[model samples]
Target: MSASSPTVPETDPVASGRPFGAVDVTWLALLGLTLLTWIVGDDAALGLGRSALLLMGLATLKAVLIAAVFMELARRGRMLLLGLGAYLVVLWLVLWLILARG
Candidate 1:
């Protein structure tokens, strides 16, 4: 409470040195997903084309979860979310096109 110390609003947890709850959960989830992915890879989940598709789907889901929760994109403006969605859609379409050609 000294005059020399800058005062911050009590509502801002970041300013108070408290960790973000969501960040911890997101990190744990990411670690679990990474382990799952490794297990899937060892089991030859990427061997067949269909299995590859499933693996890709799982990876995309993990990416989305990490982006939304860890990156705090969900709380961002609608425009940012929309852009992310569009990028994902485009990536999906490109992958589908490439797979379909083979």
Candidate 2:
């Protein structure tokens, strides 16, 4: 209540109407994906081609999640996000082609 100290607004997370934001959700999703990736790695029944493809797909999903949430691309970089989406599509296509040919 000092005259020199300004009182801040009540804008804490809960007061803001959303306790868990996008970042929290994204983090949980990433953790789940990591666990799934480990499980896929440890499984011995899947052939190399299937395993590699699954791993690659999981990696790409993680990459997109990180970029959109951690990098704040979803808020300020629409063009960059689009470009990244395109690049990932192309990358996946090439990987699939290579894996299929082998």
Name the best candidate (by TM-score). 2
TM-score of each: 0.62, 0.73
Q: Per-residue error at 5 for model 1, in Å?
A: 27
Query: Where is model 2 more than 4 Å wrong at Cα?
Result: 1-19, 100-102
Candidate 1 wrong stretches, greater than 4 Å: 1-20, 100-102
Write candidate 2's Cα lDDT for 1-102 as tens digits. 679963533543445676777789899999999999999989989877788788878888898888888887876687998899778867876796688567
For candidate 2, give the lDDT: 0.81
Tens-place lDDT per residue, model 1, 1-102, is: 688965655634566677666677778888888887777767853555555565566677777776676666765555776677677756765675677566
Question: Which one is best on lDDT?
Answer: 2
Clashes of 1: 0
lDDT of 1: 0.68
- Where does candidate 2 clash, by residue pair? none
The CA lDDT of each predicted structure is 0.68, 0.81
